[model samples]
Target: MSYSLQKKLVIVSFLFVPVALLLLFLLYPSLRLLQFSLTNWNGISKSFNYVGLDNYVSAFQNPDIWKALSNNFLYFGIHALFIPLEVMVAVLLNNKLRTSNFFRSIVFLPYILNGVAVAYLFSYMYNPINGPINALLETLGLESWIQNWLSDKGIVNYSLIVVSLWRFSGLHVILFLAGLQSIPNDLYEAATIDGAGSWKKFIHITMPGISRVMEIVLFLNVRGALQVFDIPFLMTQGGPGLASTTFTVYTIQTAFKYNNYGLASSLAIILMLMIIIFSYFQGKLFKGKGE
Candidate 1:
């Protein structure tokens, strides 16, 4: 009945649902996953024996797991290589070029589009027969350049990487654009008066100003690379002999298809640790450079 009591009740009411949901969905499932990682449960058996760190050891010793992890690294490396270009494009967009607004929408449109739809769309585009890509290559009289985009082991991973880039590059660009805009224009003016060229201004002023955004973008890249699933799963099914299979995809197959939930849980744990470790080192490395 009192004002303070009412306020306290209101605060508790607001916090109660979210905190309860977090505990139920996120925290409980995570604890179960950790428990599962230490067992030999085949997922169907209610009677699961705790096998200690055996599953963890098996994940490391498995060559297929290593191969899938390599695919993840490929995605990470390719995306990392493109961050500078994405940043440059963001800078260009920030300059308010002619048709920049139109281009901004166009660049970001792919990211908002449905991921499953994009994968299926690209699947048709990359079809060896009657595919637009091959059609265009044939039109250009470059038949030799046209090959199985999603089938060839050598090219399948790259094809999936292309899809990942298409889906996420705009997000990175938008983030950078926001970061760039936050930078004071007066700094640019001062640099201009000091006779600083475009490249020098980018290096000295722009880089420092948007360093925080850069860190965020890099962390996202690492997470995205590691967790990339739908594109590869829907497109190639991590197929053409596990060529395009990523760590996430492998983890899923291990649990559902192979019915080895214990091993899968271990792999999942390793993945979480990897993301945390990589993000930590990346932060430290960037922080060192920042200093």
Candidate 2:
């Protein structure tokens, strides 16, 4: 073999292991989940029969699934607030103020903490009787504001959303911060020279510069919102009713709590499809705008 052929062969040899592992671990299980969605596998049973599209039909007809899906939408809506909030923080921090580094670290700290730990901490904070939230409310003579944060069906979803925001908003801030840093300083200087104010400069220059990073942030937000499981699972366990139950939480309950693995697999598949469809449309929308 020539030198170029030998080098290419070596590179291919290095790539083979990771590629095989990806297929074996990620792709194989995904395919298996798709296969199981069509069956009545009780998770422990060695033998199962194919049931065609029955599970998918049942999932659609199930009221609980609808409730969980609505909650997913609510979760998505609440999580969407983080994008603007994080972008604002990122922009403010990009001004290169003296305390910017300190504030950035403070903002980014929660994203690195363990999900379970964060959930537990927030659970304690939301406790009704002695939790700091209630205590502070009473201390400020706003006793009426204190309620069972996790138990009230009306506000439990919102309460959990607060926890989600506290944990993940920092990561988005960091992402936006990086995007802001990558923007050429000359663009901002030129805008300044044109007598453009801060708001106008942000609108005409900064927004366009960080558009790609915003796409990534939006995608992550959507995916995280749809797949929200850990915080709700650890904190509320899908709650005092189905009020806080997300699609993922419902899927877990279906599989393990109810011993309906086939149905759970079906739910998982549906979620996968939703994410894929949303992502595809988002890509198309961004591409159209770019063109």
Candidate 3:
């Protein structure tokens, strides 16, 4: 084959196959989910009545939808805030302090635990009656602070957010520490010679060097937060009066609970759109970090 023809064949073989697979696996199903979101199909009898934007309208109008959206933002915000903590952990580990590796391993061990385990773990930790947290509170003579962490309408979601932070922070720490290790010691030494204090060095030298890694980590963390299901599902089941319900949880409830498959699919599509929008902004933010 000619060079151009060979190159075209290579592209077709290497690149196009994965592209097609992605379309088949991801894009097509996303389109189908979008279709379901716009119709009234019960996923039972082979009949679907087009409901137009009614599913989305219902979703937008529903108080629970807005609440879940708002809470998702909270989840994202908390994740972002914890980036500093992740950095701190990474930095601490990088110092090669005694037991640093052991401590890092211990911190990262939780991420390997399944979501159900984390939820159940948090549930027990937050149990008002006999959980360890309450026990500690009792010991400290702060028993009045004890309440149903999962059942409390006001604070259950926040409690879950804390659990999420603990679960995912280690991953961010590892990624950031890897980035930090890549930075040459000479630069840090140079900055030190210039009389730059620790804060100044971090602000000028370290932060700029790690900005790209931060961008990537931030995007992934935000995307992950948007898709969270297991923790909320296992612990609260989006319950205690829907206080912790997420968009995904709401979709599940509509599908299995009320047999509204079409509506459920429609909601799923809307969520996909939200994800797309958020992902676009994430890319923009990452690009801005480059400039």
Candidate 4:
């Protein structure tokens, strides 16, 4: 074979397995889910009727689903608020302090833990009667601050958000730290020599350097907030009369508990589209600001 043909063969050989796996695992399942969304199929039924956009319309009109979606937004908003704080924490830890490595490990430990385990652990901590959180409030003589973390309708969602923050804040910090470390030290040294203050250096040097990682982290926050399931599901079961029901939890319950697989599939598709839309706009916003 000619050299060009041999090169082509090698490229194809390397690409083939990954392409095949992507089609089999990701693309195929997504297409199947899309098809199911247009049907009136109960999950176990061998037969289903095509329902067109009815399922989607129904999903849009459902008040409960919308409430769940609002809860998702709460998750997104609260987490987004913390992104800057996480980055600052990452910056502080990235400094050449004596205990930086130990602190980084401590911060990252929660992210490495199993999600289900974390949810269960928090569930116990939030238990109304014997929970450590409440007990601590009592010990501090701040008994009025203690409330049913997982049961009260008004405060249940906030309680769940706290658990989410504890579980994922470490991850955000670590990502920011990685991004911060990748930046060349010469830039900071040069800035200092030119008499740039710490705030100026951070604004011009650190923020621009870590913008890509920040974009990714923001997209992750959006996706994660929308898809939150374990904490609310395992802890409250989206309880307190659906006060803490997130979009993903509602979707699952719609399918299994209500046996409305078609609607569930539609809800899932809506969620996927929402993530895509948010990501697209976010990318555009970042690109515009960068320019």
Candidate 5:
């Protein structure tokens, strides 16, 4: 065989394993789920009737599904604050202060911790009776604010949103920090020489410089919000009568708890579609901004 032909064959062989694994693990299961979504499979039996689009219709008509979707949107709203907060921290850390490294490590520490551990830690902290938060409030003579954080329907979602923010904010801070480091100091120096104020320099130079990282951060925020399941599940288990039930949590309950695999599959498909649609729009928005 020719040397060039042998090299091409070796490259093709290297690509084959990953491509095969993707098909087997991802594409194949997705196709099966799509098929299963049209049937009445209870996740165990081989015998299931293909019931057309009934599962999809049922999912749309179900009030719980709608509630769960609304909760997902609310979760997204809470997480949206991370962008600005992380950017602010990143910009401050970018200033070569004496304690910048120490502060950066402190900020990024939470993101490296295990999710379940963080959930349990916060669960204890938010406990109504013995948690430090309530204790501190009482110590300060603010007993009026000491209500059940996880059990109150009105405050449960916000409580969980705070945990999510605390856990993930550090990750965005690191991303923004990386973006900030890539920006040339010359741009800021020039702006300063031109008598540009801090706000003006940030608006014109910093914002434009970090636009690419901003796109990635926004996309991750959207995707993470839609697929949020771990913290809420571990901390609350969609408790207080579905007060903080997310779409993914709802789907898991439908499939395993209720033994409605077909319905759960349909819900999953719907969520996937929603993610895809939102992602498409986000891409367009970012592209327009870049232009």
Candidate 6:
């Protein structure tokens, strides 16, 4: 073979290896997970039974499962709101302002910290008796507002959502800032010359320009919110009677705590399907492809 042909063959071989390995490492396991979702296998047995749709039926019937699902809706309802909040923050930072970098780093710092550490840190701060949060409430003469942050089923999910907003707002802020930079300053100047108010300018100029970033961040928030586990795991442990058990946490509990890999696999399959559906619709929304 000539040298160019040999080089082409070598390059193809290099790419082929990773593609084959990716199928092995990623695709094969996902296929197995789908298969396991239909089984009666306990994950340690030599023998197995085909449960078919029974696992999924049970998952749908379980109230713990429903609570987890509903809480996901509520969690994501709040999670979705962060996009605008981050955009607002980023726009402010993007303006000609002193100390923009300082504030940006301060906000982004939490994203680098461990999720579990953030969860546990909040857990300590939310402690009812001795924590500063409650103490500060009492000091401000709003002692009535002080309640068990993690133990109160009514408030635990909300508390977890607040912690989530703090943890991830920085990330979305950075994404929005990147989006903001991609907008031409001349457009804003033109909008101002056209007598556009801030809100009008945002609607016609800022929002349209940032649609791509909004799509990116919206997708990230949806996926991240669906897979949210660490905060509720460490802070509440799906606690106050499963008030905040997200899909991921329930999957972990089902697999390890109950040793029911079949059920866990069922949950995993459903979670995957739900997220895929969400992503599909979100993509359509961003592309203006579907209603």
Candidate 5 vs 6: which has more TM-score: 5
What TM-score, to 2 decimals, does candidate 5 have? 0.96
Q: Each prediction's Cα lDDT score?
A: 0.93, 0.90, 0.84, 0.94, 0.91, 0.87
* Residue 199 alpha-carbon offset, candidate 3, angstroms: 1.8
The alpha-carbon deviation from the true structure for residue 126 of candidate 1, after best TM-score superposition, in angstroms, is 0.6
Itemize residue pairs with steric clashes in candidate 1: none
Answer with 3 or 6, whichever has the higher lDDT. 6
- In model 5, which regions exceed 4 Å deviation? 288-291
- At residue 168, give the lDDT of candidate 6: 86
* Estimated TM-score for each candidate: 0.95, 0.96, 0.90, 0.95, 0.96, 0.94
Q: List candidate 1 stretches off by more than 4 Å.
A: 1-10, 288-291
* Cα RMSD, model 4: 1.6
Give the number of the best model, judged by lDDT: 4
**Which pairs clash inside model 5?**
none
lDDT of 6 by residue, 1-291 (tens): 999999999999999989999999999999999888899888788877889989999999998888887887887788786677788899999988899999999999989999988988998899998998999999999988999988998888999999998988898899889988998899889988988899998888888888888888877777887789999988888998788888899999999898788999999989889889988988777885211
Candidate order by TM-score, highest to lowest?
5, 2, 4, 1, 6, 3
Off by over 4 Å in 2: 1-5, 288-291
Give the distance in Å from residue 229's predicted Cα in candidate 2 to where it truly belongs: 0.6
Q: Model 1 Cα displacement at 5 (Å)? A: 6.5
lDDT of 5 by residue, 1-291 (tens): 999999999999999999999999999999999999999999999799999899999999999889888888888887786578889989999899999999999999999999999999999999998999999999999999998999999999999999989988888998989988998899899999999999998999889888888988888888888899998899899988999899999999999998999999998989889889988988887785532
**lDDT (C-alpha) at residue 233 in model 1:** 96
Clashes of each: 0, 0, 1, 0, 0, 0
TM-score of 1: 0.95
